[model samples]
Target chain A: MKDKIRIASGSGFWGDLQSIPLQQVTKGQIDYLMMDFLAEVTMSIMQKQKKRNPAAGYAKDLIQIMKDILPHIAEKNIKVITNGGGANPMGCVEEIVKCAHKQGIKGLKIGVVTGDDILDSIDNLLKHGAGLDNMESGQKVTDVKERLISANVYFGARPIVEALKKGAQIIITGRTTDTSLTYAPMIHEFKWSWDDWDKLAAGVIAGHILECGGQSSGGNFLGDWRSVPDLAHIGFPIAEAYPNGEFVVTKHENTGGMVSVDTVSEQLMYEIGDPTNYITPECVADFTTINLEQQGKDRVRVFGIKGKPATDLYKVSMAYNDGYTAIGSLTYSWPDALEKAKKADEILRTRLSDLGLKFDEIRTEFLGVNACHGPLASEQNEINEVVLRVGVRSANHHDIEAFGKEIAPLILTGPPSVTGFAGGRPKANEVIAYWPALMPKKLVHPKVEIITT
Target chain B: MSKIKLIDIAHGRSGDKGDAANVGIVAYDDKGYEIIKKHLTTERVKKHFEGICFGKVERFEMPNICALNFLLHNTLGGGGTVSLKHDAQGKTLAAALLKMEIEI
Candidate 1:
């Protein structure tokens, strides 16, 4: 087994920096490149695209990225694991194959993990006594059965490890846990046992630290943000993982970002619910047991992570058509701008009320005044400019469209010195709501298939 | 003892899970952690965000990292795609929490 492996994170979310994968493969020595491209609601969007066109359900940016990083990664003998597959892994694999063949690269092996998409099987599962109740609200799935756009189960690192063991150069998956993309490589390289809870949990922690790309390395750093140098060319994080369940979080040599204990600690707490119970399919990692020490400049050593056995169920993410919404904004400038914006909001709401337009919710915010923190925002007197933003949600599409049409009229009749309205009348958008539920592990199976170019 | 804002000694990040939002606050040092641990209770946090967070507040401790995580339920309108609020995901909720004053 290899003594150590270097795994580099390329992308964090679906629309993350596109050029980082090439940079990671070229600017550094790395054994594997892991990219995460899925979010909570990405699958529903991809499903909509697939419904329009059968082969367009995946992260379309991956094809361009593969075209750019193919030769470099091939020359470096680096493997790639990503959940950019979204709603379709086979389609993503096919696109990569075409990109590689076009570039005259031969004999590339691509692995595809399937069976995460269960939209077709939902009715059957429900008939078989699967409650599939919403984890938060305890509501039945049948309530939104007709509106569901996408449903996929979250798989862990085992299928990915299987793909790596089968000599696959690149692996693509659907709805895989974000942490699994980083840890699967460690399990394959070191041949770690499945039941080694500490090692598995250590891998999970490394994945969490690296999953957000540059967050652990000073990108979204809150502590001493100005101390970080060269924000323009920030380097993504790399995990120098060892066989003993220890890893050092660092970036490339002479990179633009800083990797300190502070940066890593903040990321450790990002989006986490319970410090003692970070549940994944592989193990329940305890974030409270983690230990961090700054080893050198741009390097933080993470160790002593604890985890428990895996649960008997898988968390499934489903999205449905919640309703329609439209948001419009106009900026009022100078001389009691906040007052003018508040007046504009009142005029618009009064007009909507007079027109007898009904909506589920009507919300307005003065951007420069109290948009982000709402009640907690500090009182500011005489603000130079304020963006009057209004949004309405409704089950009726016509009411949303009607709300969109009233914003531009405010500049003409309601408020003076309003200028920032460049786009045409705001259009109604379908709001896709997320439904998280759990299912028995025996009901779903992950399949790994390999394709050669 | 002196009164100071929580931002003086701590920094954090916030994210959303369904309708609930979690703000993870990490202290600058162990001393700062102790100060926050004593003063930053769930009741105080709930009272601080009285109108915004309509549900109960739950706090989790991570003394190893000198951090505390606060999960504020029903804080994001309806959260995700349905929430019409500008900060639907509650990304800036941490800064709001750090604005709280504490006696140190």
Candidate 2:
């Protein structure tokens, strides 16, 4: 069995509150504190940052938060693990190492996981027969080969264990599965074997339970969302796990957010698919087998997890250049909101078609009228103003370039009272579409780098 | 050959006896239900489950969902303490059965 360590989660999304991580370590008993910071669009935004300044690609805010909680972390010797590494994990660690050294801390090793970003080698791999097709769209990688900003295959807990084995106090990785950030430390501390499926499943379950940071601890409880306590000061969750594959998901005493079966179930179902064979790089855990109950104040004990060997193939997330798309929106007022919106879209389409411009897709969505609920959306006849959002995508820059002319004309010609086009002409933007494919484990490897700034 | 199907219809739903990993098979509607039920009686499910488990398979029926929850035992061949752990990103038992086909 691996060493017994407590793993705690702090951040869920990029915009998560900052005070939570500090509170988690200060108030709870934990050996590792994890924070997640990447989302789909976050990659593109970071890519833009890297373009302007190569050192700016990782989550820079990690610097500020680490400063806030470092003393407590250092005092408690809490090992901090986070995917705030984004496209530049080494950059993140350098900042941490510099900060740690400033505080007169010696021998604090920070390890970084890299090689997930295979942007340059994409073409060579594609020529060798990596189709890297879109799982949702059924389009091949060749469809959008020129526009990809970032492509990272999610590495699970193995690199994390590798880091812990190196005796690092802090670990940062790029684009790992969110839960893997939590699972890796457990494996390292416990020294769990590769084929020991049940313990792996339990760790996976603990990661899932705490992956969303505060969600499991009560930040976004669906049952009477109004009734969840003190969300403003919500307590981030900590996994007090035992060597027996048993764990308690709880928060520091007297902290915000409620921990209950209902809240945990809601979080469990979020973005979830099959539970029985929940596949990860480590083991395939059966979420259905999880037995959770309130053990005491502010704690839910999870047990009865089942797992099997992991698959030989790893799911690779490849982003390719789809096409350039630009959206321009204009609003038309009350009496003829929908009608004017339709006119605006038709006028834009007509002008673009007249210009003989071609695109892979030219789409329009009525924001207030029926965009959210989609096909089953209700007709909002009473809406005072409707925003007409028209976007187009195409490999030909010239074709998508014509969209700039088509959208602005709608303000003066197509719809009366058509205003709200604040950003001037719509500039073409490269669409980074997701491509889910499989790669043999042998072909892909994760590299670790430690930089002291 | 039919394409194997998998779904986790019971995460925290009832018919979940403690100590068992509860999973509901879609059975692919009523017709599929008939076929799967034929092959997966509690005894048969237990037999199939036990062969892999070296443990136990506690079963429960949820006719409303038209599925069954099978709690697996000696899973991970004695809990997770034995192996390196990972986050199971969107995997389930039903997915396992869908991929793992055994002709009875």
lDDT for model 2, please.
0.68
Q: Which residue pairs in candidate 1 have backbone atoms (N, alpha carbon, C) closer than 3 angstroms, thus clashing?
A: none
Best by DockQ: 1
Tell me how far the alpha carbon of residue A394 in candidate 2 is from the true structure, in angstroms, after superposition.
2.0
lDDT for each residue of candidate 2 in A187-214, tens digit (9 for 90 to 100): 7766678898998999888887787777
- Model 2 vs. true fold: TM: 0.74
Alpha-carbon runs more than 4 Å astray in model 1: none
lDDT by residue for model 2 (B1-104), tens: 54443321222221111122344454424555555656666666555443334456655543332445556544332111111111111123333443334343
Q: Report the number of the highest-TM-score candidate.
A: 1
lDDT tens digits by residue: candidate 1, A1-453: 889999999999999999899999999799999999999999999999999999999999999999999999888899999999999899999999999999899999999999999999998987876668899999988899999999999999999999998999999999999999999999888888999999999999999998999998898888889999997889999999999999999999877989998999989988999889999999999999999999999989998988999998899999999889999999999898988898999999999999999999999988988999888888688788999889999999999998888989998998789898799899999999999999998888999999998
- lDDT, candidate 1, equals 0.93
Alpha carbon lDDT at A331, candidate 1: 98
Clashes of 1: 0
How far residue A413's Cα lies from its native spot in candidate 1, in Å, is 0.6
Instruction: Place model 2 in a CAPRI quality band.
Output: incorrect
| Error of model 1, residue B58, in angstroms | 0.4
